[model samples]
Target: MFWDHRLTQICKENENLSKYSTYEIGGLARFVAKPRRTEDIVLLLDQAQSSGMQTVMFGMGSNLLLPDHPDPETIYISMRDHIEVMPRGDLLYVSAGTPLSMLSLFGDLSGFTDFHFTFLLPGTLGGGVYMNAKYFDNVMCDYLDTVYYIDLDAPGRGIQSIHVDDCQFAYKQSIFQHQPWFITGADLKLKTTGAAFDFERINDYLNQPLVKESIDNSSLASFYRFYRSYLSSLEQGNKPVPEAMMNVVLDRTGKNHFDYPSCGSVFKNDYTIGTPVGKLVESVGLKGTARGNAMISPVHGNVIQNRGGAKAVDVIELIKIVQEALHKSFNFVPEPELVIVK
Candidate 1:
């Protein structure tokens, strides 16, 4: 209980886990800490190490499944509020907690286009870098110059960094996954470092009531509305939205991404098979399948949705069903892209 008083300022007890995950399907969690600083993370990790307490960290809860019955003794740490952005000469120093979508917005307003691919993408930058989050040919590792992180297995060492090339980034994979490291921040290469950039504009946008509310809301529909309206406002103000960004909106909306509560994709595509997982699921006639309150999305075969009050168990059951059916039909079981936290 040595750290209890300090943690009281940032931690919540018996919080609803559904509000933290995109799937909106978890039961109550005993302890959830929203750490806004790197020092806070270190302290929490240190305490856990000394006391033999279990701990887990997540960002934005965009691609995760929290347990229906969480371990009461475990402490869940959320890195969503640790946002920080600083422009250093030609490079931008972005904290891991910064939203990946914020980079897209910053690029648009600061006269850069390379980050347009990330527009409306969910999750924080740390999670993006960890999984090498991608949009078409563009990936988080593409523009990264250097990444900084803490080794959770050895928190006594403090922060360390690695160059982008040394990160071993691949399709939906990164060295972060192979090591027990906590991403703190990174420096990104800029297309044009000489231009005068007003980064405070991004801060202003983030501070708006609607933007703040949307950032906290786990509802996919609300998330879509905020970004869509924000982009329209930019257009009305004589700032033309990029065609690439518009195309992203069209693609995601056309696929009904915001129509339901679900993780965007359930399985990673095995490119060697020469068939997408969604099409495979559809071929197996499991696209609209349901188990309890969870249903395989009728619109997107790779997505499992929460109809209303789905439980983590329901989603797990459906995953099993998909794996068995796919293995029987295709001779290979597909791997899941979504992270199911125990």
Candidate 2:
């Protein structure tokens, strides 16, 4: 009952989980909390622990498959509003809830092209760090200096920091995936030469009506439109738009990433298998396969899309089909990249 006094202000009952996820497929959740600060998160943890409730935390829901029926006894925490960005000497401290795409915008404005790879990348910084989210040859941990986290099993220990070198980052894998530590934020080492990093300008961009509206809705189409239009505006103004950044636009759009409701990729590529997961799906002739309204994207074999009103069960069926087919053909089931909330 720790949250009893502030229940109305801090949490919701019988909320639709769909509105919080890019997939937009979850059923109603019994309890949901949107925490805007580290203190709020700690407090929520206290409430959950005291009440003997399980806790589920996520940001943006870009790479998640929330259950159709979440446990009524669980406390679901959405970290989307817990955003903060601060400059510390040669490093930038970015909070976990900050969108990964925003870093690409910062790079565009500040003349640092390092973050260009993240352009149009879905998900929040925390999730990116959790999975070591990658694009082409670039990976998230490459730009990080230190990561700050709170041990879920030991909340009284408060915040802890870890050097990037010790994070055990690999292709789409990070130490955070194996630990119960909750990422709070990270310090990104800045490029020495760039048009001076303007914190206010970056905040101004995030405050834009379109940007706020797009991010809050959890609609991939809206997210894509805002970033694409912003980039196009820069192009029209004759500002230098990196070729790499433009290629990202073409690649994602060409694949029709935002055209439907779905998590980006269902399975991680198994490099040891000598074939990308998409190709394997294609080879098995599973492209465009559907279970209910969820279908394997005809264009991108690795992507499963919600054609319309797809349920979590529909997507899960497609996932199982792919896993079973691939295992039969290749003798190894591909590991799923999509985090299915049980």
Candidate 3:
């Protein structure tokens, strides 16, 4: 039993975590905490440490896969509602819970134009920072001025702020990956634009209809589509073919409903494979292949989708099967993009 009576509105027992993630697939968390203030989070951490309890922090839950039956010993920290933002001239200090979509809207409304590219992404500022989320030739690290994070190894536990350069960001990774620090907030440096950035192209992409009757139902949006098209174009004499191909794929795959409960791209591209894995999978006619409700999307081989009521194990098993087949056929193992909660 937790004795911290001060945490009246911040705690929950056996909280269902499925509703929090994009995949909507996870077991209950033994304990869930939603502290209003940063100090409260520190105090909660202190108490959990004293009690020998392990802690995990989650934002909007976009790119995670939790176990079907999660370990009851774990504590989940939901920072969804603790969001707070303060503007400082060309910069904005933002708390971890602030969603990227909301931040992008704030930027647009406030005349800060650089963040417009992030308007369509489903992620929190913290997770964006962690993954260095990028699109339209810009990344989260490009606008970051500083980061404030909890120091798990401090002799006297507390939060510390570090400059952007110190974060050491690179392709979907950061220094925080090796350290035990938890991001609490960040400072974003923005610039004002005289003209409003046009989102007509993005809106057009989003408005496309899903190909419901297609044999390959796996669909992709944003980066996956961009990357796949880039590779396909390179294969075709490096001409401007990808631009046309993207439109074709987008038209065939329903735009708005593709990412309903997906773990995003189930695998990362392996450059050593020499050939794009999607083409390889397509060549083998594995597109639209299904394993107990988990299907290799026909729209894009890199994507795997949950048809209905698909279990985490089912997704994992399908991933394994795909990996094995791809490796045996092509002699290269694919890396998974989704982070599995074991």
Against the hidden true structure, what lDDT does model 3 obtain? 0.68
Q: What is the C-alpha lDDT of each candidate?
A: 0.85, 0.88, 0.68
Two-way lDDT contest, 1 vs 3, winner: 1
All candidates: TM-score: 0.95, 0.96, 0.77
Among these predicted structures, which one has the highest lDDT?
2
TM-score of 2: 0.96
Candidate 1 wrong stretches, greater than 4 Å: 2-4, 191-197
Cα lDDT tens digits, model 1, 1-342, are 435577677789899888888888777888888887888777777777777778878887889999998888888888888777877777788888787887888887777787888887888899899989999888888889999999988877888999999999999999999999999889988655565446778668667787666666667777788778868997899977789889999999988888888888989999999999999999999988999999999988999998999998999999999999999998989999899989
Q: What ranking of all candidate models by lDDT puts the best one first?
A: 2, 1, 3
lDDT of 3 by residue, 2-59 (tens): 6688766688888777766666777878787877678878888887777777787777
Better of 1 and 2 by lDDT: 2
Clashes of 1: 0
Clash-forming residue pairs, model 1: none
